[model samples]
Target: MTDLNALEDWAGPLLRKIEPAGRAKLARTLAQQLRKGQQERIKAQRNADGTLYTARRPHKLRDKKGRVKAKAKMFQKLRTASYLKAQGDAKGLAVGFTGRIARIARVHQYGLRDRIAARGPSAQYEARELLGFTVEDQEALKDLVLAHLDL
Candidate 1:
């Protein structure tokens, strides 16, 4: 599990010491980095464990013999809708999809079962680390925080 509290603890003091504008800037930087990470995951279609995301369940567009009639890119809408929001107070950032896309992403991220009218009952998907912080990300966040601190 992600130690988000630990990250908050590490950032709290530094954020408190900076001016509000600086703090917001730092927060935006963090959000940008997080957004980049998420975009990379979508492009790679692999989880943090280096495993490719399970092939998307086949669709119902099949011909007479039960062969697929058409192919569609998986998660295309979800990928396109991914976004980032840096809190104005500089206390937090959100990196994920919004609206309907948000619901779909959560379902996939946790491998939760859901109903798809076109596809029938959905299978449990493999849990994918959609917004995990890598060691490199942590180091970079630390550096960004330190750079904004008064020391």
Candidate 2:
């Protein structure tokens, strides 16, 4: 028979007691890092001038003779460019908005993320069992985490 409780051994007594605090601290650190990181990203990321996306502008119909009925322009922003670089921006090959990768990004205003915790402890927890650690879900957690920890 498999001892389901055996996992507790690995977690140790802290699992029941310290885990919450550790996790809260972790969450707190995560929020602070993410927020600062996002700010840095925004600061570093060049103000996008244009991109391959939807655009809106005033326009006018043209005549066969080449008479302009109206004038207009397009609007767009390439989100890809703003993407955090591999090492310089993110810690490593950043993943899409998910797990720890996302939790890290949650602090960002635009939710832009780096790729640091791709395959580490934070990554493992965020992906494996950080149930409420998604971008959308981390909102309340962010507040709580911030409150719990110094950061």
Candidate 3:
């Protein structure tokens, strides 16, 4: 299980000052902000390290006649499949993507190897760090938390 407690040191004091309902609202808002940051990073093809994702492998876009055809970028489907859901309760709020495509994100994020097709050999993809925390993300989170507390 992911430990959200690590964030307590940062937002705990502010969270404690709010009522239960307000805390839930703040958590939901924070979750949305985090989701937006991740989506932006993926769209920009950048990892948490600020490095560009590996150039997409070229696709075979030629027919037998050597005519060029358009091709989609690698992970295009996965990127478009991104989503964020916030779950709030009296205890706190949890936000995450709940879909099969999230598995693909985890694979790429960790550079894990898996088979592309049945009977095919496993292939390893580069680590993309799609959902990692960045410096900008920290600043954004802080600003968002403060703003929400103000309301």
Candidate 4:
């Protein structure tokens, strides 16, 4: 988690200078950019800290003819904009998983144990940070805010 006090101290003056309409627009743009960056990181199977996510357990399945199916990427559906939403208003912005998918995301996010299926056995999922603020993200936000302000 980021230091709220530090962020407030740093951004408060800049944010106060913008009118309400401009603040809302800035928030919306920031949310979209944050969402885009998150999707890219997820696609690369990387955490916000620049570490690779733990590999999924090998689960080989064979066709009737005995050919092994290729492994699919993780969080394919979860990474989409529909499931991973970006919401922003004059007050603030947020990028996160929405609805029932949030439950599934929580399991993997904290290395929690959960059932594999409706009646399947439980298994431990590794902790993979699905969302976080990174150093690059901070720089991008700073640049974006400066550009928005025409500074």
**Model 3 alpha-carbon drift over 4 Å, by segment:** 1-7, 64-67, 80-90, 93-95
Question: lDDT by residue for model 2 over 26-132, one digit each (tens)?
Answer: 44454444434433333444222211222223344666677766543211121122332212121111223444444454533242334445574321112111111
lDDT of 2 at 74: 15
List where candidate 1 sits over 4 angstroms from the true fold: 58-73, 81-88, 118-123
Model 3 lDDT vs. the true structure?
0.71
Better of 2 and 4 by lDDT: 4
Ranking by lDDT: 4, 3, 1, 2
Minimum summed lDDT over a 10-residue window in model 1 is located at 80-89
Task: Estimate, for each residue in 90-131, the C-alpha lDDT of model 4 and write its tens digit.
Answer: 899999997789999999889999999999999989999898
**What is the TM-score of candidate 2?**
0.23
Which residue pairs does candidate 2 place in steric collision? 55-75, 58-72, 60-70, 92-115, 94-115
Clashing pairs for predicted structure model 3, backbone only: none
TM-score of 1: 0.72
Instruction: Write down the lDDT of every candidate, Cα atoms only.
Output: 0.67, 0.34, 0.71, 0.87
Residue 140 of candidate 4: its Cα lDDT? Answer: 78
TM-score of each: 0.72, 0.23, 0.79, 0.93
Q: Pick the candidate with the highest TM-score.
A: 4
Choose 1 or 4, whichever is better by TM-score. 4
- Residue 103 of model 4 has an lDDT of 93
Cα displacement (Å) at residue 146, model 4: 0.5
CA RMSD of each candidate after superposition = 3.8, 17.7, 3.5, 1.6
